[model samples]
Target: MSTWKETLFGDPFAVEGDEIDETAQSEAELLAKGNVFEQPAATRGELWGYYLYYNGDNGFTMNSYMPNILQSLAYMGGFYYDGNTTAQNCNNMPEGAVCYVPWAGGSIPVASMLLYIQAIAFSIQFVLFTTFGSLGDYGRWNKWILLSATIIGCASQIIPMVWVNNDGSQWNGMMGMMCIALISYGASLVFYAAAFPLLADNLPVVRKARFDPNVSREDYVLVAEKWRNNVSAISTTFSNVGFLIVTAVLSGASFAPWEKYDFPDGVAHILGNAPIFNYIATVFCGGFWIINAIPYFLWVPAGRGGPQLPPGENHLTIGWKNIISSLREARKLRYLFMYIIAYFIFSDAVNTLNSMIGIIQGQITSFNGTQITILNLVSAVCSIIGCLAFLWIQRWFKIRTKTNLLIIIVLTAIVPIWGSIGIGSTKFGIHNTWELWVFYVWSGIFIAPIWAWQQTMLAELVPKGKENLFFGLFGVVNKASSWIGPVVIGAITQSTSNLWEGWPFVLGLFLIAIVIIFFIDVDKAKEDIRLYLLENSDEASVNGQEKSIHSVHDTDRPVSAKDEKFV
Candidate 1:
């Protein structure tokens, strides 16, 4: 008769204080009575709008700007220190460089400067995530925060255009611009991720039907799980689509007519002659991001009143407290905590790869702009295929989430190994550019499902109402180690003066993640969250405290029905 018992076993025939009826209702009748098929049209529309816009921005940043920025920095650093002013060498350099290089005497090493910038950006992001992560849980400004961060983040991309000189010789405040842009981009992501749970919970359709009078607790859970899975899959797909579009556009722009067109002095100066395609492509991608993101601000509602703030504490105080509480609670949630550790390790490898791959390709393979664009386009296409395939395999075949993730982790491990050892080594005969292309495309296929699965699993395991707080914790775990990988890799590469050697560190991180993931008990983690919410629901209500619950969307509904009987 306990909550956990009812949840684990079906309670289809049980009614309040009444004997079970042998044939109370057919399964189809029960489903209809519960309104399981009543989709929330408005909610779906909002989700679609937000997902489309957000994913578009995400794609533009990842496919266009992020790579462009990192490559630009590397090229500029080379220009400054080595005085390599070749067309490819100066192609992506920041502005103001034409007026101000050769720094009087000496310049910092490119690798060292890159590592330092990464560290500073991630450190700032960690502080911001710690402070702003829980704002949505307490205040009515979630949407505003998301909007402002996104706008500023997008606007930051334009700074290089204005400040960097066209000639690739000098740029005023180039370092400052890079730092600000990174920080702003990082801040926007925290807000963007924090918004996911809200979107999942607040779908008017799900909220309305979740509390059907005739619905069994098990049935309700089934519905909620379906929604979570559907949303997660769809969101991921949209993100991939966004990446694909950006890649296609950029790749297409590399062709003859566009390549031959003469840009204005300011534009041409920012874009350089080595590969004029990148400059115009970057600006086009930035514009794409800003224009696409408008719908998210317009369509998504923020902070639809849930938990009240604790007495005498504002969101800032509560945000800090939430971080502390999550850390303290980690000991109690062993499986969840372990999973986070695993996520941190693997994520470090993934993040480092994303941030550094362009630099590696440019420096090691001497890839031209056309080649790079084609490579990105192939990767983007593969990513889309991977996401879609994952959804099919999971839904049609019904594989366990942990099992699928492990498979992905193992496959992903192959990439670093291939890159570090197989590519140019005598052992593998993969010495050609086409072979390298195959390896990269293989990597893209495996990497695409990682974020989708990771986010879905975290959503599955997080305590219900405190998504923002836990996601903040997720962000903390993520960003805390973000810079470490880059720093270690950069240090190793610089010390050895070999880019290939640093990649083994990435392979090791992934292997460690695989081992840790093997020990995580997903079912036990979900159970712990359910039990915790059940035990604390009453106390939270009486004390006017905020705690995890079944759904943030259903906060206004009676708790005794769902909390006591279902969750």
Candidate 2:
């Protein structure tokens, strides 16, 4: 019958019941270790931690926004309409005026080329992320990856200024553009993989509010119930704002429209391309990296202590060794492996579907550039609302209720995929294009939480000592599976699907993937970090506070004679 406010301050899980002796428990259980994890009465950062976290999140969020912008342009240019031909359906264009005049006479295969561009980019990204994930584990400057990604993103967008033709087929220009994209995606993966391990390093298990050895099991469960609440706050207050900004850009007035160019609206414009948007992104990216770089160099403390390796290990050897070691460690955690499997299946599907949304709009309707952009803006706003709604739902359900929630999310995701089947077919007097937007909003709402929750759950599953290595392997799964989604749908659409039937097949697979979500163990996830913290903190106290915040190893544990000397 206790209110949430009272529950927050008073331990409802008190083991000694109503007469719980906090002092005696402190003495017997080696507790007053609370002081070991003390915060200052107040600090400038504490007052501003929320703001700082927003900045960090915004930095990463801005980093993610680059891909959406590039993809938005690509989808509209390559898939929705032509990037190469005469300007059409607009007030400013001459009747037969051509776009990208340089490539006007050349025969260009646009769709295949774009696919190749994406495939090659993703391949490079996979390799870079694998390497960066390893580096992040062993305590390299992970934040630098974000800087690299931002620079590459800006450079990629800007490269079109020199290379693209007004006609759609700037073969050389496209190749150069693809190369820049490769570098950007590669760097972005590195940034993404590197950022993940920070949670393990910076946030302690007790601070996570999921575990305390001095408390009883019921109280621990009570604390675990708040895990989703914290993440929900993080997602809504930080993550949604980024989604809003990016979506706004995509849905606003078109930066490069097909009407100003020469050919059919869907053709490629290889030359005489407008570069204003690219310049804006480049400037923003430069600012983003410059601002974020200062914090990495100044404020953030290095927890792993300047990256020590056992004698013969440096970047090359250590990097390869780290990958192999991470893979080996991953094999040991069955729970993590299962989650990785489920995540890959679900996330890859989500990515591919999101990537092609603009194209879907273009194929079904004669919507103009501004409308396309605005629709995307609407989608972004809707997505933020969807993400926030999901988090609110999660908060409503106690942490232990995750098992049921996962069942519902996974099950609900299937409906959009199923609904997408008739999306372009037009069943109820509505054009397929309008229905496609509805389906897009529907799927986005259901699936937005899956990404953040999966990461949070993975963080829980990771053991204390192996957080970096485990998450590194998690990155491997993420990148490796990324290509599969795009390749599958792209291939299906290219080979078998007519203008009518292709999207439904892709939707079916999305529906099929939902069944696997039921197999995952949310109960284990809820208790995992709590269990890890309780175990580690107790051992640290028992050993007379010998534990460094970074490293907590037991000195008294018996080791084989041969291995003992290494420690």
Candidate 3:
């Protein structure tokens, strides 16, 4: 066994016993000529930094806190909740409230404004994900790309501290900041997720299994799968831990349980101290994130970078080109695409379900900051617990990645199924305030691990050298359909004046995704990927040639009957 000092990074995958033909192997097998692929165990610090980096990005900016703030602003901007009269949650907006708002115009509900913002942010990120997403693979750009986005995202959160208006007079500016923050956060996540395969690929046990020809490809993949699960779960736990720590301290300090001493005359109104304190809590989360993240960039070796780009290609052009190649490979790479399709649908449903729940949750808590923070605190603790619990359960069951996913998918449906009960009656489902408590605990424990398992599964499916491009596409699929659920839910709530109306649609989506995923052949997918590498190892070079991709796509290999469904 290699010691911690051993450089376990980016050593190319080589078969020791097989008499392999040089002609059959792409020179571009996982690493480029003379690229440094060696990093020691200290890289855990790097992973830790990257995971903790999400605190401000996801924990603060994209969490329920932002929605609560936005909805609060909306109420101030003239959207109120009246039990007797409200618009499709909107159509009945009180005469005193502003029924029509800007950006899309017409009689849009005030509460739904944030949903449209969610959609538009994803719309922008779709462009970013497709454009710059592949750039990280060609050089040591992944580190810098993540850092740059992290700064922008954190700034977008902290910058808002300067503007605090109880009347929501700064609503437009706040909306702009939210879009910027969400887009930046989404991009950072894509780049961050793209690193998982690299880390898993480089683990000592995996590296040994990878190079040992006696270890069957299936056996090697098993090693890789275990490490992938470990890395994803630990990293996710670290993220939620960061969320736990920062949210707890900040919210506590902001609320100030002790009786307040009045500020000296005129200072009370300066920077609108109360709102500023809350906003500063958000800023504190960002600062803590940057502090934890700084060490990773300063050290930690980068793993395999794919083949060098062709002379004329730049970061912007390479991603779009690679993505096009990936789409063309859809027929041949059947199981991967099947998973992607299932992911596309279920993720859409889940994202929408989350948004609907957040809307109702805010109503249950009356959009109170302390209440929201407490829920977040509870969620953070449960999220960490969930990730750890998942790893324990997986180890105990000795399950495959697909089996783990099936479990998560089935359990995740419970959220929407229960929420849908509200469609028929207000007495049960997500109607009561207590359900919000249950929602936080339930989702934190079940749904949070879905991300860990899903990412682990994708790491299993993606071709070795093309992790960045495939992960980028993973992000594109996520962003591409994310807006659908939010937009549809917004319209549903607008038409019905009831938020519960959208749960059934989300439940149906969950059912469809579950069915599709259940039928997917994970074993077939693994075998296909194994064969794919042998056939197209040469084409995997990062030279950015369109013809090479076309050739890969046009392989003379024939597809069999059962595999035809994958195609």
Residue range with the least summed lDDT across 10 consecutive positions in model 1: 558-567
TM-score of every candidate relative to the true structure = 0.73, 0.61, 0.73
Candidate number with greatest TM-score: 3
Query: What do the candidate models score in CA lDDT, each in turn?
Result: 0.59, 0.44, 0.64
lDDT of 3 by residue, 89-113 (tens): 2324444333334445555665467
Error of 3 at 220 (Å): 13
The candidate scoring highest on lDDT is: 3
- Global lDDT of model 3: 0.64
How would you encode candidate 2's per-residue C-alpha lDDT over 201-292 as one tens digit per residue? 22334232322445653454334334323432442344345434544544342444534445565544421123334334434434443453
List all candidate RMSDs to the true structure: 10.1, 11.2, 8.9
TM-score, candidate number 3: 0.73
Off by over 4 Å in 2: 1-113, 136-146, 162-165, 175-179, 185-189, 192-239, 246-306, 317-335, 364-368, 397-412, 415-431, 497-512, 521-567
Q: Which of 2 and 3 is ahead in TM-score?
A: 3
